[model samples]
Target: MMPLRTIANRVECEIEIKKSRFVGVVDRAATEADARAVIAAARMSDPAAGHHCSAFIVDSSAGDPLADPKQQRIERSHDDGEPSGTAGMPMLEVLRGHHTTNVVAVVSRYFGGTKLGTGGLARAYGSAVSEALVHARFLTRQRREIMTLELDHAEVGRVESELRRHAVLVLGTSYAARAVLTVSAVDADSTAALVASLTAGRVTPVRSGHMYAEIPD
Candidate 1:
């Protein structure tokens, strides 16, 4: 299976290169809209910053980023008027090098009195992101389908235990007239097989939607 990774949480850091201040932030963002929101928040926080350059990559397990990153992922970058290829492209390259998905990075630059050429600007912006990533926490997740399995009170305890023992993630549980377990499986066929074996064909699960959830490190 293709491994998918994401940020554990948001991170913020600052670095100074040649007297220029670079403030960088990284966060988990699965969509273009989410990435834009993060970029907007950074701009709002530092309205006076000289430039706010940003990059993002959003992908799924179905496609291999290494084979064709641009085609496989929603990849984008913006220099934010610093130069043609100095700020944004370098930040985007750093993210791609990290092989992380569903994440966004933004670097706000406050220029110092001195001027650094294009190469210097690129290095500063990229290093800013790299510095922030030093404090980032990462986690692996995979695509999983949600399912609901209802059982009488008597069967709930044993059935749920068996489900966990088999590595099925129990998303939620509710009890009323009966017990309903919202669980996750890799796919419907495997889920059906597991449920049949667990309940001896007496129960069927209703398929819901899909989601991404953490796996062991």
Candidate 2:
């Protein structure tokens, strides 16, 4: 299964100018459904807001039996009540500038006493999105490879030491007469190298596929 991609953490902040309020939220979502749920919750939170515009990107190819191609890019935008293009497009530009993928941006606006014209609205929306990005938490996207390595009790300590030297992430350890270690690496080659190095041409580890980042702190 292909692991889901998303921001490593969450961010919440607000910006205002000329009586216009831009409440921006950056959230980490694993699925498209989760992203929609966030937008729905935001709308419900501000029922009387002037507009509740949103944008998001997602990729889901987990356990594809047919080997369906994975979507490298997914982009969406909603204008809410603002004139078309004024609210959504500018927000999209902010995402593009940051080269952000598999992320969502939602801007909820509460109208002030005055109306922001088309140009003014675009500026406000874009600036709000930009600020949200600035405050957002980022995670490094890494290909996670899981594998099992076998070693006798005597070699366990040295094998573990080698794995750590290569920055290999140990997921678990099991002992049933002999010790076996479950490890995660960034890619297939790394996993293979670790197995070969620790086993010394005697033991081998089974291959596990990619892994994705969990929510960041």
Candidate 3:
């Protein structure tokens, strides 16, 4: 699967444009419902603000087996009483230009007895979100195949060390009469090959499913 970029954590920034205060809040939103929740949270953050504009892009293929993982991107924008295309469109454009996905941005506007015309409002709102994103941390995520390897306790340490040396991400490990390890790899074939080589054909790995794993931005 293709790598996706999103905010590492929630971030907020405030900007003053022509005496009007614009507060921008950005967060990772993996679905439409998540985006709405973030919007609601933004509204609650500044109840007195006159306008709350929002934009989001979510991966529509998530949890869907037949969907085109990378091509199925969902985008939404809301002006929230600002001029038709002023607030939300520009915010959405900024996100698209940055190649960010599964994220939402909301800009709350508090009028300060001054009006920024259509163009001014667009620039202000867009800039507010852009500035917030600039200061925010980001993460890259990709779909990985999950597998479990069960082996004798004596082999656990050596196999795990070798897997780590090969850059495989070991999710967790459990102990019983044997050691059961949960790991994730970019593909199932690579995981099988690694397990076979590590155990010299004495152990077989079981495939579980796919999960989104975070990687460095």
Say which prediction, candidate 1 or candidate 3, comes out ahead on TM-score. 3
Q: Return the lDDT, model 3, position 3.
A: 61
Ordered by TM-score, highest first, the candidates read: 3, 2, 1
Q: State the lDDT at 37 in candidate 3.
A: 96
Where is model 1 more than 4 Å wrong at Cα? 59-72, 145-153, 172-182, 186-210
Question: Evaluated with lDDT, which candidate comes out highest?
Answer: 3
Model 2 per-residue lDDT tens digits across residues 52-121: 8888765554323222214545578899989999988888787667656567778999887888789998
Taking the tens digit of each residue's C-alpha lDDT, what string does model 3 give over 1-217? 3366777888889999889999999898878898999999888878999999999998886635333336778999999999899999999999888778888999999999988899999999999999999887877767777789999999899999988887778999999988999887886787688789888888888988877765667
TM-scores, each model vs. reference: 0.74, 0.78, 0.80
TM accuracy, model 1: 0.74
- Clashes within 3 Å, all models in order: 0, 3, 0
The lDDT per prediction is: 0.84, 0.73, 0.86
Model 2 spans with C-alpha error above 4 angstroms? 1-5, 61-73, 174-179, 187-199, 204-206, 214-217
Cα distance off (Å), candidate 3, residue 49: 2.3
Candidate 2 lDDT trough over 10 residues, lowest sum: 61-70
Please tell me which predicted candidate would have the highest TM-score against the true structure.
3
Rank by lDDT, highest first.
3, 1, 2
